[model samples]
Target: MILSVQNYGQNKSIAKDKIKVLENTAQESIFVHYNSSLFMVGEYMYYKIYCLNSETNKLSHISKIAYLELVDKEGERVFKQKIRLDNGFGQGDFFLPVDTRSGNYKLVAYTKWMSNWGQEIFFSDDVIILNPYSNNQRDFLESEVSKEDLQSKSDLRPSNSALSELNKSPLQLFISKKNYGKRDEVIMEFEGINSKKIPDGEYSISVRKYSPVFPNQKKTTVDHLESKEISPPTFDNNITLPELRGELVTGRVVAKSTDIPLENLKIAFSVPGEDYQLKIARTDVLGQFHANITKPYRSEEILIQLIDDNVDGLTIELDDFASPFNSDKVKFESFRLNPEMNDLILKRSIQNQIENAYFKVKPDTITSNVNELNFYGTKGITYLLDDYTRFPTIKETVLEILDNVWLTENKNDKYVFNLRTLNGEFNNSEFTSLLIVDGLFVKDQDYFINNFSSNSIEQINIVKEYYRMGSQIFDGIIDIKTFDQNYAALASKNDMTALKLNRQTEIKNYFRQSYGNESSKDLERIPDLRQQLLWLPNFEIDDTQRITFFTSDLKGDFEISIEGFTHTGKPVSILDTITVE
Candidate 1:
């Protein structure tokens, strides 16, 4: 029996002879909560991710990892990081470089499983980063007339009364003081209507300079000023939906001559540049298959080769899918900087320079030796290379100085090295012996033996018995310690991949200044240029959850916005503004 599944909203039919697969497959989505949409250079962008099953609106456990990419305006990846998700939740931070240009960037997030649907399902948001010291300047002022004529128009200055009117909101928000000085403490409180206790929900508060539009400003011209309020997720009145996933690649295989469906055919997905391990997928009864790549491809195209033995007259059809999420639908209120805000920006910029300088002088120390204290609870035979005389080559030292090691010339005139037990029993097993240099895996022996010098060796460790690491079982282990941690660089020249075994994310403590109990003399010595005065990612609103944070050395109106979802998936948003003079 022939079964044809019609493509949704398309004239073509897919999986002509296979069962309906689309209806049986589940849909997944990604939701990310970022600390702020706008950032300054030299600052860290922190975010929390939540992966959910769209149909059930519950957290998904299918994907254990998520790929986060920061892309520039020209579609170039600024940075990419793989985040390990736990129970559908993950958190990560990206540090913005000081040399980054002042422009709009994007934060894209998706999981490997989500890629099967298509890139249209990936979650993406626009992020604006400003670098005051950047040579490339983005004009904030727009006009058809000359700069002098534009400045001459008196209506350019927004009235101070309008600024006060925009500060009001329906959500009950309270401040400890109406005005604050530079580096002063700002306390805030939030409650439901009629002073009732606020319900449990997720929230994000953003404080930024308020930008006001002048009367002379044209509506058609795009303003460079950032939005003061945080961008909240779109909801259907109260129901919150799941986030979109990443790009998806889908295709079908059919017999070229008879145009018949080719079922159970294995296809390989790989990039041609490097020998990346091929990802394999099998066609279903209808000759349809799909694969999800968590991140966008660095190259414009990818190669898909059939793995079947007989491929004389077989054809593959690729499809271009549309993105499911529309960024334009998410709206945010526009804000223009007034005189007071402009003054605050100038002072904050100066303080930022001081902080950056301080960090440079006292940089964070990162430890290079990850396995210093832990050595798999086993200490094998150790040979200190420094104690013995240096040999002309590593092969000579291995053959002469080392015991239970064999070096023999192969038929190709190349040398083959093997490790044996003290009893002269050759350590022969199904899997090759594990070779490591400076805690990095050594995949190729020629790359290690030829490039690595005997003089640069620090020590050698050998394990004669079989070793087991997770699912990998090695016949034995040969650990080579280097004098310096530069073995990876030297080995990379021989067309080999040398990767750091440690995958732990480095912990960074952000610099925070305190003046509450400090002496007056100490206050004068410190410069405060903190644009983001307070950032609390996981804030709970229990009885003891009193929000208190000190303001930075700037004078202007600081906005407080709280956004999150309730236990029942109801979206909530609260806004309030406080002035600091």
Candidate 2:
């Protein structure tokens, strides 16, 4: 929220107003609760993000998008994704790829609004990865160890978390039993020590087998609450606005000839696909324009163009979404692989391979109920092409099958589509009808009329009433749907500038296994080598709630962790252990 002002006289007043606005804005912080700090090559790393108001420590409603990234020891991004936040909560997961080498890594999470403070206030955690298949184990091995010493020397031991003298969390975990057989159902309950301090909040539950190889101390909700009380660093005159609406797409418009910024220009942008969106933005005093995409679009690229009749040889340049912050400042701790852990590593590797081999039988499903709505509301007259006789050309099909719609030339001698009133009145309005093809804006009506075949079109929609978007109004709308849905091929590359956009990450429904079912009986022969019994990345905790999940075939001690912030912004961290015989 800091802005550097170069000209003290011209922009002096504007700078003061901007600084006043930022000073009133509250800062934000993030907390990420992850399943485990240690992982094998084939395991999935699940996490949940909680955005908080730095002052109140409650869920912040300022930002709608958050980013999560996994960085290596050298600070290069290994994986990054855009998460669509819903009321300050989001969840995602990543599977460890086989090609990833064994090393110590870090997971960082932050919202673009949090960037105003700096990367130091961002949420970060250490992660240790073990890869037995790759030869990149040099970092985890002794430099002078001999070949014989690497096989059976018993010096290597797993790292353990040091016991702390801090006060325990008020939240306690209640389980029905301490031990159970494989595939047995276990129910865990949550309750607070005092009735007034009941644990009620949005929490994440993870039941993972304790990693005995390279386990690192996992930070809890309380730890984050204590460490995240930092304030915004002193501003050196750099400012970034918060994305209050949605994903913010920003750029600058400049004159093509002199490379000078052009101010007060209007730009029309469109994201083309089934869920395409159209938006309008205007350049400010700095020649920069900001547009917020309110919803998720299917297109990987966007089209932007000047809305004016004469663009005056102006061009647009989009800013990259990559963060400018340098992540190379992070330091990693050393974790050496000892020969004593070789037997345990081999067993886990074999189990992972077996579980992957039968993965096709039990695959995760994508929970997609994306409510697709027409960019324009649902009040247009639709036509089904198959209901009538087949026509060869678009002009003939529209003339014969359509009603109250026709193509005519405008004052500029350009062909444009016009819609008449349903009462058969010839509309002589000043505004032209908006033409669209497969969710893409079509400017040149002549080109589409002559080149597009009726055989390629599936349906046509006509709206006789005037339509408005932003400050622009159209007399009517002519929306056409093509069979192939390939709007990119029809888009006029001459008038539009194509730029890549970083869209929100897709949501998925994690696979869950249950016993005593018909499908479970059929897969009884397949080995159940799952180490992590259950993972709920977004679990809502009530006053006294019960959770039920069946244990896996893997027999060992599993850690149950519930970490999050309560409705009143109080930190709740509870831990317990269960043994599966």
Candidate 3:
């Protein structure tokens, strides 16, 4: 005998008079709260889930129905998923994907939908990552996140994303040398350029260079410092970068009996003085010293450091900021001035060098060096910009993403207002009083279309304002934040009005079920705030002219009688300020 009776709100009939196969409901252990495991190195997050009905009974269509793996404590599995089904009875949601790594995981629900051919409905459990890239408050308190489809962002998940760069433009810091009373040979350079494709990584010019010029104490405190490794060389228009190689003169150093100038000691170049072995030059914050010459020390003969006893010496005057017989010496890099240069601090340094010239880009054609130094000055990163060999590619680097974050120019109201409708002749398709957003409603469009259904939103942040009847319809109030939730991340408009507003207006009216199958034990014995505002779905009820008036999708109110509006009944007028769109 083969019988069947699947019912979850009724619907299932197939008894061909009976034949066999009715063994479904037994091995059930559903508990998956597997939560979004932690991650951040490359970043990703997901947890969506669905699978219930106490376990689809009398089910058979190819048997073995459940699978969702992700193991990694040596038992090794990293990720897996499978859930069979063909017709009739159904179930779907199962995202998971954080990629893998960082400890104890397992959201298994196996019995073999294919772990190479299954047989173990044993429901394993243990997903506890803790800090994947971190969004803490304990993951918004273990988020349950309701409704979240928000807007069906077409499946986007290309490994986090970010590769747009054009860095290197902070060059020129030629340290203090010009003081050649007899040329003490000293050089230290670090200019940069590699054809402006900058992408070599390990960069840190930092610079706070010091000189033989010392004497500015704040109760001093110097500590012997040493860090050497140069000789990679690169000079000239390519922009010089001898790394910092060539400086050997480690002499003088004694404090066992009061040898003046040792106010804050910590010296070590390994002492030897005068050309090769006494690299004495590492002092700053007032006891200045710096050395980096690769030869021609102005006709050589070095041997200076006379004090702490490298056995007394004399032959000073190191580079007075460049002067091989000086030629009208102007000034810039090494603080060398006197040629009278001060047009209000070089016109405020040429207005911050032309407002930092779009934050200096010009490099990275795919890791050739120089990345993200404001690449074309800010937008959501993912840029291998010029010659683009595959960067920022999630369908053409999406509106060059700049969820708007780069500040330093007066506050302007904490900005972010770019919600469209200012152009295309600013139309609201006959406004039925739209513009809701302020929320306590259907999961706020389920967290605004499920956390950013994929890029295209370069700016939009109204926040509050939407009159009605008296008309202001909505000057402010837009809540779509998305950085990447992936609905194919839309946002194109310079008239593409993001593919012409996506036209989807179909709500063939239907609403009458104030409360059915409710339960918190009937919401603790009927507190019926009018059938829970009759199921939301109507907008504009803020600047307080008070008019909720919805009738479907559930219920609605805020009605203070102006006939409790929704005007569902089309009336005449009050001061005829006319309102019907």
Candidate 4:
């Protein structure tokens, strides 16, 4: 009996150790409030993502980027976006293609650092999208049958009248009318308790179709909320915003004989076949090291080696920390359109097709900002390729047609282009010239010389003086322009590292129209096929706020749902329905 008591105490001690391990590790959670649950083809699905620390339920400062994906039933990713998070908040939009199949889709969100755990912890939600142009009669029939079954089951369930009488939330929702007509204006009012005590609450108001098949699915939403509630507080209280560290690979090192953490261990990452610049990092106090590689390597595998000269009894453990969001608790709702709504959808689909065709033919009318060009304040010597029509090879074209440049061979039997100074001396000690083709870096000199043809070269610009940009310094720069924008396509066939240039996220302005005090004739002339009547992503409830939006030409029941978090981190959802005849 004494031995049994001792074993019980030992088991308790082991359990406590396991709990401590979990407490030390940092975890992240993501929450998103999308405009609507249902969408039509050619429409945009707008959403705002909120990333929080799992332990404190506050905005996470550990991850600066969030990934959003739209996956189909067959586990295929239809669309993906890498959103930049500022203070753990990001907003983006996904355009539903017209050819998309009608079915239940998933919207998943997560961060790169959060991937260290399993993907099951990622936030996921269901979105029902319908393509009126898709001619899948079998799918439509199945969807209709499912909707009928759900409506029947819902009718059999007991009424909420008794439950409503027992408890009431502090929030109240009101609408000007219970019914509306197509292109009619809808006014809404929301009231709550004292604003001072509650603090102004932020909310997302969306008007989507009401369907029993999609009835209040509680899997991802509830699990994400519950996990935040249960996560223990972190040991550290200092909140620091995460920096944009590129392609982080983190791991720990320890001594094999003594089982002691090895601090300041040097780790190096290099490409096996290519002459890539080695990336090095050092282990911290906890024997943990994170390597941030700024460029992308084309090799399939990278060799990671311990740079320490004396590696007698050291052991290294390397693993990937990519965890994706899970949708285990996600459920789909079915929506069936009435005859009137179906007719309107058909008309809208045709209208969208016509608009798309028109834009394709007159694309020049849609201009982009010229200030977004990357080549600014750059003045270099330019040589037109057309001036060298008789050259047989690119090397011949460069040497015969261009001046102050010559070719030299290295010890590895590889040809290297050397940039000559005005004094006719080779400027090639430790400094290397920068080679760029169509705004992309050319890492392999041999690949560039052999692949680029003389005819394909449109122009070449040379900057002989030392050029400095950010942390990089080049002895000189050689910029090659191709006749066609096919530099990436040509470079893809080689083993050179091609780094993608970062571009600003395109800002999209949603289409909005109003017909205030206009005649019916004027309204009929314009195409009124908007599936989303009103989308208010940022809604505050400090005082009574009135929202006004005119409905489209679609006649159906539009459900208004307000979902948000209170100042105290409590989740709230309010629902109401309006009919437009």
Candidate 5:
């Protein structure tokens, strides 16, 4: 039943060209045609075959023997035929005949070396793909923008070098000899780049996360060198912006009827599975604020919380305005001040002022957690521990409920704890503690079990792994008091610096105490400069006999104002030695 055409050609012995072929083996009458134009997708159809040069193996410069065949689904060779080709891999046509009623078929028509093996049977896509290319891109905006400038020197500061700077997360880009043109030390200087005129959409900010190795100069010949050194975390975040890059955000506040714009208002949006929240922004004069944040492949919805401690502590202001807000005094009218329409007036009545405060909280996530809770002035934090997970202890034969797990830290010297806004005394006390110590969450105010005895804590699973760890992941030393054996370590460092003294460092410290009132332009104040000896290993002045210190600008020259102190830590003698070297 196999159709043969090799013996039927008019010039069978001398036929040196290839032919085209087609087949039908499906339920529905399948149409086989090359819809090539960009045209009606259904117009560029007819019938053709390939005539390969046989010398080269491609349709472009080789030989081809093409044919069309119509066979039954069971491998029965029904009809074998041939067609011609006018163009290569372009618009053309071929037809097939079927005997079956209706079902499905795979009509594959391919040349010996064709790139895109064309298929006639269309089975369109029907599955979801999760490859990198398949995922949606993240949004560049819609994130928090800190008011601080970041640095590459310290990971803590807001600088271009810090990995935590905006837009640097999620994706990391590097320039290396391995990837780029064999170059090392790729120094990108943005001394004249401006971002003010750029539109507000997202753009891929490129930066070199890694540089190449150092160059090596061998004997006579120059070989490729790689030192693999890392620069301190600095932000190519461009160091400075033309201004506090801003945008507009719209919102309304009813209870505090004052038309004054909320100042220093912080808004945070956290995408799930993300390392950090977007950013915290400050409000303008009219309680209006806008934060500039970016996220690639942004999440659909983000978690947002508005906070301002000076104007009002999150829960504190919410508490003070509770009664008035609930009553008619804090009524929210329409837009304007129409007496008949009664647009809610911003009340200036309550004056419970807040000194300092912060919010690192989230909304309640447990059913037992309070439904509606209020905090004054400060913005509401949404993330909180609201669950009691019951676990069985191996040593103790009883079920224990674990509840009120919270985050703790310290600011200055005071401690803070971000607790769930539950209708409980302990947690409320914790919120009060946050106001006193700025944004710190400390150990004392940590949310704990309600009725469980301290002895019942057979296995307290301190979630240390969940925190950014170090000497104080909890942000404060909870286990040991300031100075005993543990103080041994801190005391050792102080004592060690207490070792060698460079006459220069000794003089600098002394001058600062006399001037600047012991204040520093950096994040902290300069140490009391006047309290040091010239010959000590600790003060780090163990340099030379001739000490030289100079004051900035019009402050005057560097004078080694030497002074002696008694055992009681009081100044005994003042020796003013003005050295030249």
Candidate 6:
């Protein structure tokens, strides 16, 4: 609900008294390193995001979340992704669909903290996408290239095995040979140039075929450091806070009938999964609340609800997923598709189709590296329902099968539960114990006790010790595991709100083509028509740093580029060419 002017003024005063307003001193900027500026249908656009401190030119630790968007010429968003940052670095990839129109699109990246200043601090680069399957190419192929334009582009092309140095790069890239055949192993070494000391840092490397139709779209590290100067924003009461801990989800609450802001209400946020997380936050004086999700969750949806008895009178509203920055300021480049690129585009499109058909044999793995512990502690007494005698209702099941847990009804016809302590007794406290079903919080005790039974539940866990979440304290815990683990089906939908969260992008182990191993026999029948041989978004430079990869079956001059920052915050950008004959 939109707050009135008087309410907003009171909120600002309360915010000033409660929160410490931080000045925009250490401003942040983003620089994205992408694999290619040109793409076709079924091809993936790989990119790495570098969140840097503008003043120091080093990695910024201010924000843990970054946003990447693909904006079209009309300032419309084609796709948007929310990426999780690790030490000011993050990587993600998107596959171009066959239905995408051929045009020049802008790839934009920025953090929440960077959005406060404006679009000037955002990292934006023009990209060309060609779709042979679609006929909508008016924006790109409206006019033919002039004879002088073609000559100018051809004259600027680099020779074979040429190296383009940027900012007098300290590191040197070495290759074993200038030319190689298909499926040949290529080893590259990176070291200090002229005995110069190479500062330690993280870097990314990409080896892709150089297509003549594409322009010079690669951005040097020095260009960003020199161009993006941080201008501290003027002090304002409504500044966007940096996500110092984790992904921050902010929203407001208001009365359903009067549309008035509801303040100081406790809200529960649940990310339901096998390894779920439960957090609680209270709305401020302005009816706005922020919850920080520090842990990783597999579920793509989350539940948010008020934790009070008068939840039905309030409406919980969440902020929109669209970026707050204005997209009209983005300047797009005109893409003139030359007539000579027809055959090349057809060849690449066919190769992409062939490679995608055999994607099952060459699969990428989605990582599932998360903590196994549940939100509640692991030390709890678990009772398997199948081991006990069959019971009709949960009330009977708890009394007969369970040991130290007791469930009874009060005079108001509401069910209550308590955990027995070591003295073979329990306290008669007025506070209610926490109840969970399939990792979801169930506030209505009568609904769970009357609806759920031994037939639907698989097991029950009881924790006798007191557990605390946010400002609410529970006397004990009674976590019920459902047979289907269907929290949505069993959860009380009276006052709860479910939202589809833009969860962290899944990190994939990109399919690597290797001809030296025994598994190569399986890939012999599969057509190896790969234009981009290798894309390492996170490349480590160890003590004996050596990078190796095999060239694809496609013959061309591949561009090998490395972009990153050193420990001393110095930018690093190096480019070299290798021909595969």
Question: TM-score for all predictions?
Answer: 0.56, 0.88, 0.14, 0.57, 0.18, 0.91
Q: 2 or 3, which is superior by TM-score? A: 2
lDDT tens digits, residues 320-426, model 4?
33224444445544445445356556665675665445333222221232342223246578898776665757789878987887777766676666788756687
lDDT of 5 by residue, 214-302 (tens): 11101100000011121221212111110112111123222243554454444432222111113344444433333332222112323
Pick by TM-score: 1 or 2, better one: 2
Pairs of residues clashing in candidate 6:
none
Candidate scoring better on lDDT of 5 and 6: 6
| 91-157 per-residue lDDT for model 6 (tens digits) | 8898888878788888889987787677788888878788888878888767777777755543344
What lDDT score belongs to each candidate, Candidate 1 first?
0.53, 0.75, 0.24, 0.58, 0.21, 0.77
Candidate 2 per-residue C-alpha lDDT over 287-375 given as tens digits, one digit per residue, 9 for 90 to 100: 67778888876688777777666666665666665663466876764556766678889988999999989888878876665777687
**For candidate 6, what's the RMSD?**
3.6
lDDT of 1: 0.53
Clashes of each: 15, 5, 70, 7, 97, 0
Worst 10 residues of 5 by lDDT: 216-225
Q: Find the candidate with the highest lDDT and give its number.
A: 6
Clashes of 2: 5
Output the lDDT of residue 23, model 5: 13
- The residue pairs found clashing in candidate 4 are 115-321, 115-322, 115-323, 119-324, 122-325, 213-333, 214-333
lDDT of 4 at 509: 38
In Å, residue 224's CA in model 4 sits off its true spot by: 5.6
| Tens-digit lDDT string for candidate 3 (473-571) | 333333222233222223211111010111111211212222223632333332222211111111123332222121112121111101001111111
Question: How are the candidates ranked when ordered by TM-score, highest leading?
Answer: 6, 2, 4, 1, 5, 3
> Distance (Å) between predicted and true CA of 359, model 3?
29
The prediction achieving the highest TM-score against the true structure is 6
